[model samples]
Target chain A: MEPAEVEFLAEKEPVTVIPNFSLDKIYLIGGDLGPFNPGLPMEVPLWLAVNLKQRQKCRIVPPEWMDVEKLEEIREQERREDTFTPMPSPHYMELTKLLLNHASDNIPKADEIRTLVKDIWDTRLAKLRLSADRFVREQETYAKLDNLTLMEINTTAAFFTESLNHMYKLRTNLQPSEGAESQEY
Target chain B: MADELELFEQGSDAGSDEVLLTPAELIHQLEEAWLNEKFAPDLLESKSEIVECVIEQLSHMEENLQRAKKGDLKVSIHRMEIDRIRYVLSSYLRSRLLKIEKFFPHVVEKEKLRAKEDPSALSPEEFAFAKEYLENTEMFLKNVTLKHMPPNLQSIDLLKSVPQPNLDSFVFLRVKERQENILIEPETDEQREYTVDLEEGSQHLIRYKTIAPLVTSGAVQLI
Candidate 1:
């Protein structure tokens, strides 16, 4: 999957936004949103929050986990753990970029949070690479990937899968009678 | 089926106790289907019911919005929601088309092999598209190269020429329902095959062939 597609899916995650303009409860096909009273906070999807922020119609409340203190702790915990640590949000990486890029003013210590998130991302990626190398080197057919998020998986999906395919093809060629490729097709 | 997401409320068929799937839950299912089709190596069974329901929902929302004033904020929010849902709907259909174009022969063959009582893997329109694509491809091959070849070589097996989806490819997925003792086949002869139990909500990286049934049954989801 393309990184943009992962970001697209992330955009659907709900975020809290305080709309400046008052509006009645809007019934959307996916469900309902708003009943907007000016200055009161309500939950809206990230896509809408960004749209409203661009028009200066709302102040996005950076999600609870976007705080610098919380993220610093997360980064520390991530570095300490060999396996992936549970993320504050499933799309934490995408959410940070989206929120920080569009509405930095709403979030406190935006720069610090950005750096912290980048640190956590890099740390997790290194662990992912190490594990992937082990998986390949060991020629393991199955692996439990608990706590790995979609964006994390997508970063190496294409190259990793292609290499595995090539290795499998080469391995299978040695066992010519068991041509698994032609069996199903 | 509605229980698969675990985000829905509440009913089953015990004589007219119809499951009340909210519009939100229906959209969730459509999105799941979209992602599954996108990641899956092979074409999955067509979710025509979900496709039709989503289309109906979108049009119904649009119709309601038609009566509202242009500058109305509610109208704008509704429109934005409509656009978002429409994007998912189109992307879902487009991805299916891409797969069909890649494996037209296999897709059509699967459709034929399906039992009469079973649902088709392709929607009616997609079935037509695959059939036509196959014929056009053969005709093009014949016109361009096959005609000039020896008579004995003129007849070609499209199936042999086309590549099939690699079922052995590893995929990232999350379990929806807990399963016990799923056997994981070894990649090489020296390796011993073993079984692993799947716990609900945990993710895994495994060969597609090992969990193809889980994908179709909605027990596990491709990430």
Candidate 2:
């Protein structure tokens, strides 16, 4: 993929950074990164923030969506809506996993964030199971999923494939004689 | 040849006993293979036999098509199914080839630099196919970086600098074995050796790069 595409994926995924030292604006190929001030939080791409955090140059402020209360609200909204609710980022799961893994100490209430993320994931997956059941019952070839993160899509796709295979097996067993004849041919 | 035929027959018995795989079955197998490759890239070596079998079946189907068109045989096969199988097979192979190309960028670069002197560095089959994949990827990378990116960033080598999102990134994993004397770098710049003695069910957030060997060995799994 192009750098622009990569940047587009990263653009909306903001991580808060608290630099230890003051610095003038640092230029990057895509754009200027910062005119960083000591002890002040600034939002930057997850990648840049993680890089700086790994180097002990900055501490990461978890994204707003990482808040437990906010996630609970979003989860409720998702449950109520017949359609997928708007997500903060298409790559939210991945970004959250990356940030939490790399900068858990830097985050406020890290354990709470982790629990909430897990709770939300479990709820979403339960809903996905329901939808997948319906999809298989109806023998739908495609589904339009809304508000699903990339990780959820991967999980759902695997489930869908399994369901499809099961249905194919059922269809085969329903006509044992025809199946035998077809096999001979 | 008889053993190969018997294997094909057994696969056919699961669906229809046609000389070649039905489109649905082919697609299903392809999807399974794709997923297997995605989750366990090392298992790809084992899958080569399956891929070869599919290719052989496809050639047999092609010959059947020719005979049916000449009115010398009566075979029942959908043209659209053949087309679909071809499309899926090519796409599956292409995606895997791209990943292989990306994973070994240094090797690919070296092969390019020494193309004339050591054209046989890659196996004959790999050299023929990977040469094209490498060239296409190179051109795509160049266009993206040199033209689409800002002039200052044109010289930035993306593959070398950019962290691969899924591959080199941090992952939450559950330990499955009592690993000893493993070295890891934490948030601090110091490298530490820790015996990963976490209870079997305990999970930790680790850089996938640090635990890749363990992952392959089934000592840890991405959770």
Candidate 3:
């Protein structure tokens, strides 16, 4: 049964309902399902409903209440295959070195180590924000790239995709050092 | 009061280490605080004080979430959102720390070589660059604010909107946008249709920006 049926069962029965085992399981997102899949009683696969467009074969059954074009645009973005380019930030080399060194040796000052890594992470992010802001600020200049000899728009997209990938990688890598805080209930 | 004391004792019990509050429970606590403020002001010093205490505990929890990322602490999946927001807020600060750590070797090298030199010997450009660097870093961080609708937005009728396949995503607005009815299982000819009706005054705060993102194949719906 789909996530909805399982959620309904959860309410009525108050028992943990695991999704029917499908050998040909669709990997919604990468990594082990350990964190997300804790049976029905906890998370009722809200992502399955919200993360609709990302599904391989499922088409979005549009609601009758909102704009159709907006829905389509979101779907298109979800399905879009972005080209990757390595837009290494200036500080990427420095940050990697620091992380490698610290991870190698058990740093005594955990807070200090966290602070150091975070600063580098922010620097890269700043460069990314600045780039986006610049594009908006100089939209005329950016748009004019279409007419120019060089393909500046493609370059900008490449830069953004690369920067974002690096930022995400840095985040995932750095995540291991930082302790988990029980901020919620 | 006796039950409350019992619960406190139960919470610290070695066998009951698994005992933890659910998201619903946390929301209820906030609601209790809000209710206490409105109708039972004398029951507590103030509502804001209780909320502040909750927020403070949440902030501490956020820190632990960060540490969890480092493999230093174990975290359950449910608490991820709370941690995610905290990380988003502190991302800039973390980035600043990272920059310092990354450039430490260079800084140390420069310092060692220049140790014999006088502090005033450095040119004004060097000092200005240092100041500009710090300021830019701070500016970049201040901009990274959380933009998503907070969990509190779903507070009013959180339970009513249960997740069900073909369960209508359209709640506040009219039933149909462009299509006749939203199809949950189009191939199987299964569909759940509902009309959207919205309140007047809530339009300023809440309106159909877009249909909630649909999840699966054959899950077709109108805006």
Candidate 4:
């Protein structure tokens, strides 16, 4: 399976496209795309919207979730929750990054969105670091890391491996040296 | 030519080469090789050679460690370097092995269909290495099952169950050219053809498998 981040952005997240000219339906591998009419709003995959926007054939309408006030509320709720609060989309971070990078001009309050996203990311990362510290200190073998994003996973994977290796070394020191005995024999 | 001859001579002499590559150089080489393989997997004809060199250096480091452990030498700083090199080498190989395993079925099918010796995507050494790895892993699993697990599980083909890597992986990439009329088969739909316009700096999140050939041909690049 693809990471939830990639899967959500690629498949589920929708972008509103306002085409500059009328067009008949175009067949795609996923499905038929549109009967694009000039100045009328039509929803399409983010990928297609970006492509069309790049070609100067359409202007993209940013999703409602990009709102700074909405994200702030969500961040507060997330901070209060003992478990991970359900996000608007699994790929919220990646989507925000992509849209901000590609279609900033289309989005309202793009700068605010960028700052809010960064704030949310930083808060979530602080929480993740806390959990990681507890995990290492407690020497837990298994963890149910609900709501951990792919980016988060990538960041912590090396740390987890190093901690595990340290634990293994400690365990080995507690036992008789197998290599030493084998070499002697 | 002289440097190449010296390297060959050093390799032949094995332990006699006192001035082997510094740990930093070895680490740099490993990272470079990894990046090279990642970007242009098909161009990795020298991967096995690099792996061999790293292994030899690793063994030499191990020997030094053994001597140090017995108070016969003083090289404690090398310990961290050795561990770092080992980790990098293992990861580099593991990434390559994962790719090889994921594409093994595709490679075999393509070879049979085309009736060719070279599978365009993977080097001959890489293919053989992957095949051997699969066999060894299967044997190891069987041994574990026989020793610890119930006999009922013995019939299961564990090797076959190793899921292919990045089958559904999506990548953010930019099209470098006006690739026209490309055919793509989505996971849940029939094949469809579309013309992609390459207005410079256009990016999309596409299935890596769909654009892998394009990536290899430098028509697109992962961002």
DockQ of each: 0.52, 0.01, 0.02, 0.02
Q: Which wins on TM-score, candidate 1 or candidate 2?
A: 1
lDDT of 4 at A110: 90
Misplaced by over 4 Å in model 1 are A174-185, B1-19
Which ten-residue region of model 1 chain B has the weakest summed lDDT? B5-14
User: Which candidate, 1 or 4, would have the higher DockQ against the true structure?
Assistant: 1
TM-score of chain B of each: 0.91, 0.41, 0.20, 0.46
Better-scoring candidate (lDDT), 2 or 3: 2
State the lDDT of candidate 3 residue by residue for A1-185, as single tens digits: 12332232122111112332222222211112323232232222323322221322122221221123433343343234232122222222232233233232322443443444444344434444554666444321111111110112222443443443344345445342232222211
Give a tens-digit lDDT track for model 1, residues B1-223.
1222222221122122334567888899888999899889989988787888788788877888898789876788788888878888899999999999988888999899988766568899999999999999989888988899999989877676677777888888999999999999898899999999999999998889989988888899998
Rank ordering of all candidates by lDDT, starting from the highest:
1, 4, 2, 3
**Local distance difference test scores for all models:** 0.86, 0.55, 0.29, 0.56
Winner on lDDT (1 vs 2):
1
* Runs with alpha carbons beyond 4 Å of true place in candidate 2: A1-12, A22-31, A79-83, A162-185, B1-127, B130-223
lDDT of 4 by residue, B146-169 (tens): 457666755543323433232234
Off by over 4 Å in 3: A1-185, B1-24, B32-45, B70-80, B83-223
The digit string of per-residue lDDT tens for model 4 on A25-64 reads 6432123456788999998877666656776778888778
Query: Under CAPRI classification, how is model 2 graded?
Result: incorrect
Flag regions of model 4 displaced more than 4 Å: A1-12, A169-185, B1-223
User: What TM-score would each prediction reach against the true structure?
Assistant: 0.92, 0.40, 0.19, 0.44
Instruction: State which candidate has the highest lDDT.
Output: 1
* Residue B167, candidate 3: alpha-carbon lDDT: 20
lDDT of 2 by residue, B28-140 (tens): 55544554345432213223434666677677667657765552211221343355456556755765665556544544555567645322234445556666665676687
**Docking model 3 quality class:** incorrect
1 versus 3: better DockQ goes to: 1
